[model samples]
Target chain A: MISKVLVRLKEDVLDPAGRALTEQLNHLGFNEVKSAMVGKYIELNMDTGDREKQKERVQEMCHRLLANSLIEDYEIIHEVIEKKP
Target chain B: MISKVLVRLKEDVLDPAGRALTEQLNHLGFNEVKSAMVGKYIELNMDTGDREKQKERVQEMCHRLLANSLIEDYEIIHEVIEKKP
Candidate 1:
């Protein structure tokens, strides 16, 4: 089973890397760019069980290892690419 | 209009951040984690057009701003939540 996790900061938090990128982008003449934020994508392949249980395991993984729940929020979605429809 | 961009390192590229996280997870006793990689997701709300054109603009944005095309591969997908089905 393959699960994809997307994690990002809550909107109210300030993003230093994003601010730095905005500064650099303005210097690069991408002057019209309005917003910039940074985050992460994590993919996990596991030897797992039924779909619902797989999802639960992925969520637990996110809560335990994939994200800092205090500042970052994460979502897990899965795809079964190898199996036929 | 809204577009979601997911960007990640090409399969052969080494991810230093991910390696660091793996070490940390190991220390935290997540002994079963076999692999870890880090990437990004960017959501943009724009004033746009037909879904295809909107997607084109998003792809251009990913190429020009959201991703470092040299080392990353990115995909842009759009959702029109404003006009519900």
Candidate 2:
């Protein structure tokens, strides 16, 4: 199974990196860009085939190691990848 | 318009940060995790309503600033966000 985790800052949190990118984009002539936010995309390849187990493990991973619960939110999606014969 | 851009390193490239995270996950008891890869997720809010122009601008942003064409690949998705009444 392949699990994708997207971790992003909460709506109320200030993202300085995102703010800088927005300014830079404007300076580079992308005046239509109103704002920007940067987040983390993590892909994990797991050896398990059980969907329920994969989801559980991924959620645990996010809670313990991937995201900061105080200011960040994470979403997880799972996909089953077939092995190449 | 809202544009989501995902930028990830080419599979041929080595990702030490991802490797370290994989190892950490294993140490933290996620032994089923075979490997991990880390990528960037950027969200941009644009003032335009034209999907084609938004896509073009996002592609330009990726090429000129968001992603390194030599070592990374980017995927873009556009969504129309409704304003509050």
Candidate 3:
């Protein structure tokens, strides 16, 4: 199985990193740009037959270590991919 | 317009972060797992009609700031999706 996450700042928050990138883009001569954001994606492959239970565990992992839930939100995806038999 | 980048450890390299994540998953009772990888993704929204020039600038931005080309790799994409008028 494979699991992936997309983590990003809340829409109402100010993202300094995102703003800096936009400014750099303008400086690089892409003034037609408006705004930008910086985020993270985590990909992992494992063997799983029970996605329901596995997803629950992964969500706990995200809450404890993989993400700072106070500032960022995440989406989880679990799929049966890449059979290693 | 938007640009995104995906950064991950090279396939041949060892990732302690990834290893740790797997161990934690197993410890948390997710024994049906094999391996894991941790990576980053950056996303931005900007206004643009000239995707060619915009993509060029975004690529440069990634090289100089958004990504460290020495170890990380990136991809560039451009599209005319919205009109601010």
Candidate 4:
């Protein structure tokens, strides 16, 4: 199975990284660019027959350490792959 | 328009952060997890009536600054939003 987590700062939170990118974009003549945001993309490969259990475990990982729940939001996407013995 | 760029380390490169995450996952009891990868997700908002031009500009941005072409790969996703004006 493959799981992907995308974590981004909350709208209210200040993102200096994002701001820096936006400025760089402007400097590069992308004047139409309005805003930019920088975030984390994590990909995990795991083996588990129980889909529900895998989802729960991934969520726990995100909340416990992968992301700061107070200042960021995360979305998880997963795909299950079957292996032949 | 909104553009999302996902930049990830090449398979051959060593990712200490991903390794650390994998270890943490194991400690947290997700033993089935085989590997984990950490990457960057960047979002940009721009206005360009010319889709082709916008795409080119975004690609340029990725190659020039958003991603390290030598050690990373990037994929861009975009959406165009119409304004009521």
Candidate 4 docks at the CAPRI level of medium
Per-residue lDDT tens digits of candidate 3, residues A1-85?
Answer: 6887768887877899889877877787767668877777787675656788678777877887678888898878676775478
- Which 10 successive residues of model 2 chain A have the least lDDT summed? A74-83
Which of the two candidates, 3 or 4, achieves a greater TM-score against the reference? 4
lDDT string for model 1 (B1-85, tens) is 6666789898899989878876776677654556667788776655555778767766766777778978999877677866758
lDDT tens per residue, model 2, B11-61: 999999899999999999999999999999899999987889889989999
Comparing 2 and 3 on DockQ, the stronger one: 2
Clashing pairs in 4: none
* Top-down DockQ ranking: 2, 4, 3, 1
Clashes of 1: 1
- B1-85: candidate 3 lDDT, tens digit per residue: 6665666667667878878988987787667658878777677675655678667777767767777776666656454566579
Runs of candidate 3 exceeding 4 Å displacement: A50-57, A77-85, B50-60, B75-85
Candidate with more favorable, higher DockQ: 1 or 4: 4
The TM-score obtained by model 3 is 0.70
What would the DockQ be for model 1? 0.44
* Backbone clashes, each candidate: 1, 0, 2, 0
Error of 3 at A37 (Å): 1.8
Per residue, candidate 4 scores C-alpha lDDT tens digits across B39-84 of 9988888877788888999999998899999999998888777779
Predicted candidate 4 versus true structure: per-residue lDDT over A1-85, tens digit per residue: 8998889999999999999999988998889889999999999988777789889989988988899999999989887776799
